[model samples]
Structures are given as C-alpha cells and as structure tokens.
Target: MPVYKVYLDQVFLGNLVMNYAILWAAAKLSRVPVHTARLVAGAALGAAYALAVFIPGAGFLQSVWFKTVISAGIVAVAFSPVTVRMFLTCLGCFFLASFTLGGLAIGIIFYLNSGRLSSWDGIGKVIEGNFWPGILLGLIALWAAGRGFAALLKKGKFENLFRIPILINSGGKQVRVEALLDTGNQLKDPMTQSPVVVVEYNSLKSLLPEQVQAGLERDGEADIWNILGSLSESSLSSRFSAVPFQSLGRANGMMLGFRPDEVVIERQGKLARPGRVVVGIYRNKLDPEGSYHALLGPNVLELTG
Candidate 1:
C-alpha cells in the first residue's frame, strides 16, 4: 500500500484558511462553543477536501464553484439545518475571503517570477514555486484568523456526561426506563447514609392491588405485606423488601418491590448492571410525555468493581 503525504502547498493553505473561517462562522451561527464547532468543521472539511482532490474520478470536477459547494457540504454536516440567510451569509463571506486573498497570493507569486499577466499556468507555477513556504504561511494565517473571529463571539460552557437507560417492570409487564445519573442526588437514610432513590406513587399502581394503592393514597404510607396479601394469599412477604431512604429533607423508610429477574442497563452498545436498585413507584408522572418509565436513585451500587 502506498502512503501519500498531505502536502502543505498553496492550494492546501488556501483550503485550510477558508475552512477555519467557515468553522468560526458556523460556531457563531449555531451558538455552539467555538472549539467543538471547529473540531467538527475541521474533520468534515478535511475529509471532503481530501476526497475531492485525491479520488481518481473526482479531480475532473475541480473548480472554484465546485470546491465552494464541497466546503458548504462540510459546513452543513458540522451544523445541520441553520437558517438559509445565515448559511448563505457565512458561506458568501468565506468564499469572498478565500478567492480574494488566495487569488492575490497566487497573482503576487506569478508577477514576481514572470513579471507579466498571463494564464492559469502562471498561477500553477506560482503554487509550485513556493509550495513549502506557502504551507507554513497558511498555518500561521489560519490560526490568526480563527482567533480573531473567535474573540468577537460569545463563549459557552461545554459538558460531557455519561447517561444510561434502565429497564423496569410495571404492572406485571416489562417497560424500558431512562434515568439521569446525578451525583448531586445524595439523599440517604440518616442512620445508614445509604442513598435514597425517589419514585412517584402512580408509577407502581399496576403492580399494587387496588386496596393497597388506595391505602397509600389515603395515608401516604402502607404496611408492606398488607398490600401483597391482596394479590396473593400465600406468604409473598419475602418478596416485599424495604430499603431505607430520606426524602423532602426527612429520613424515612421506602418500601421496595422486586422482580424475579435482574434489571439491566444498556449504554454505548454494551450492557452493565446499574446496581441492586430498589424500584420506587410514583403516583404522578415525572414527565407526563417523557419516555422514561422510572428513575434510578443513587442508592444503587454498581454490580462490578
């Protein structure tokens, strides 16, 4: 396999400079942090430019308009579906700067070498003549231009957090659950300091018998086995467990119901044990239209080290 070096020449410099400008414009228009926008734009543009120039059949489409369209595609990929006016304005500004400055540099090199205005061959010669120097100049120019544009735009905080999806049993049926892992939810039993998980009462109604549900609604708490008897006469008391929890700034005990199987959480195409978390059934919806069936509390400890 032959490895091709990415040459830093006049053409490369021009492309990089225009790409940086386009990236800065995208960050401003999208209201995203500049570094993130730049990273996305740079990756997109670099790949597209490489494809356009190096792919065997692609070289035939080389033109200013063609390259501009390619650059626009990169911008679109980096920041999907911006307003048409903003897209056009940013693209237009980048195009003008790229063509004018790049064309001027090419023109200067031609004049210095041949001393006369001529044809496209003159521009090509200019590029070939000062290839290495142009690469260095282009990198410096791109950095300076990017910094200048970024200084004028507002900056935002960027956070990268992990999120996991959970599965829970509701009303004797399995339902998919989504929950946020918040380290800030440090509620625990005052006696044990074991983390408290909160759930709405309405969520567990399907699992509870009518009488038990009514009792909870009337008094806000119910004896654990009293409700289980409504579902079965046999001793199901072993299944009805309680995990201590603190809520509303007060320490209390939470009744825990169990499913025969272990709950699994899927993240990034892999499965993991979230913890031996007790399910808390809530009466009201956490978010009425949200997809999550229940929320997992911090009391759940990881099954693995």
Candidate 2:
C-alpha cells in the first residue's frame, strides 16, 4: 500500500491563490469592474470547499451538481449585480482559465516526472513541495502569453470601437464614465499637443466650476468663446485650454478643454495611465442611445501602461 501526505495549509493557500487568479482573469475577460475584497472573499469560499473533502460527512461536496453550485457561488460572490448575459460570460471565462492553467500544470508535471505523478486529489498535491520553481516559471510564461494575446487582439477583429471604463480626476474630484475608443478621433490640443478626450458636459458636470457649467449649459460657439476668455482672469485659467476640431456639418470648431489631475483607464483588470490628457466638454450628448458618454483617441491607448 502507498500513502500520500497532503499539507492542509498548502491546500488552502494554494487553492486560495489559484481561485483569485482565475476570478481576476474571468473579470478581465468579461470586462467587468473588479472588487478586490469581494474577490478575496470568493477565493476564500473556494479554498473552504477544497478542504471539505477531508470532513467525514462532506461526501456531497464531491458530486458534480454540488460542484456546479459552488462554482456559481464563487462567481456570484466575486461579481454580483451582473446580468444573465454577463454572468454566463464570466462563468465561461472562469472555466476556460481554470482548465487552461490546470491542464498546462499537469502536462508540465507529467513531462518532468511521470513516475512520481500518480493520483490527483487537491491542487496542492499537483504542486507538491518541490514544484514551486516550475509553478513560478509557468506563471511568467502565462504573463508573456497574455501580453502577446492582447497585442494580437488589438490587430484582430476587436480593432473596431469598443466601450471601456475610465476615471478622470481633477482638483480632488473623480468621475468614472464609460468611454468609446474611437480610432478616427485624432483631436489634440494644439498648444500642449495632449490628446483630447471628448466627454459629455453632464458626465463631467461635477468636476467643472460653476462658471464653466453655466457657460456649457448654453449653446453656440460665441458663448463657449466667451467662457474661455472669462476664465483667463479666473483661478482655473491654468487648467483650461481650447481644442480645435472639425466634424460633420461643423468646421473649425473649438471645444472647451481642461486638464485633469489624473486619468486612469482600466483594461483587462489593469490600470493604465496615458500620461497627460485633456478633457473636452461637449454640451450635447455624443451618443443618442446613451451607450457611452466619452470618446477616447487611439493614441491615448498606445501610451497607456
């Protein structure tokens, strides 16, 4: 008879980390906001499930139905308030990431030491005590693969305009809004050469001064110009600028632009700062359907970290 010793701490900790990674990857794939504390709590739930097999009367945990329920529970905890479509997408990505990583680890372990690999119980057993180095190397490989995949996607079918979440912070005020990445948008501030992100005036209303808001509420280029001229004597003169643009039915138009303290774009579970960017205020709605409130220039995405 042969015996296998599984460290309980390793089982809990290993599954915890693995669960977190899978949840994060799934969130990125589903393009949803990530809550770190919720993810950690969800991972803890998964780790608890992994330990249930050790209990005397916990045989029900091994059933396929029970396993499905647990998986759903994990996702619900991590990404609550998701629609049915989004929930399905998140679950699919979760399974895909889990299978891909699990299969890769198993293949590598088998290729290295087929004789030592016998029965797979918990994830800790697959990692064992001596396989930490291989795991670390595998993580590095996955990261490189992810970067390459992102580049390929950019040039692939996803090159078209897509919605993304962005945060604009100025004067200790931050506004989070959905923005469309427009490849056709090449608008930039002529003075500083910073890319201009056109946001609906209502979307940025909270961040603007009372005088600026008053001017934006009115129509016509004359009022906009008046506001720009008036701001020179105001305290916000340094933060304001003029961005010239040409659009359909409008030529040589100027937009009210202001410099934000910081702009952070979240893509694939990562925060990308596109250096300095100007926020252009548009009095009218950019999208009639209200799908997105802001427009992002392609160059900004390229400069993101």
Clashing pairs in 2: none
For each candidate, how many residue pairs have backbone atoms clashing (under 3 Å)?
A: 8, 0
lDDT of 1 by residue, 70-154 (tens): 7677656655444454456455655554564465555545545675336777656567767545544544555565566556531
105-159 per-residue lDDT for model 2 (tens digits): 6567656666666666544565665375555555555555656665664444453
Q: List residue ranges in candidate 1 displaced over 4 A.
A: 1-163, 169-172, 184-197, 208-211, 217-232, 248-250, 253-260, 274-276, 284-293, 298-301
lDDT value for model 1:
0.52
The total number of steric clashes, by the backbone 3 Å criterion, in model 2 comes to 0
Candidate 2, position 47, lDDT: 98
Candidate 2: lDDT of 271? Answer: 90
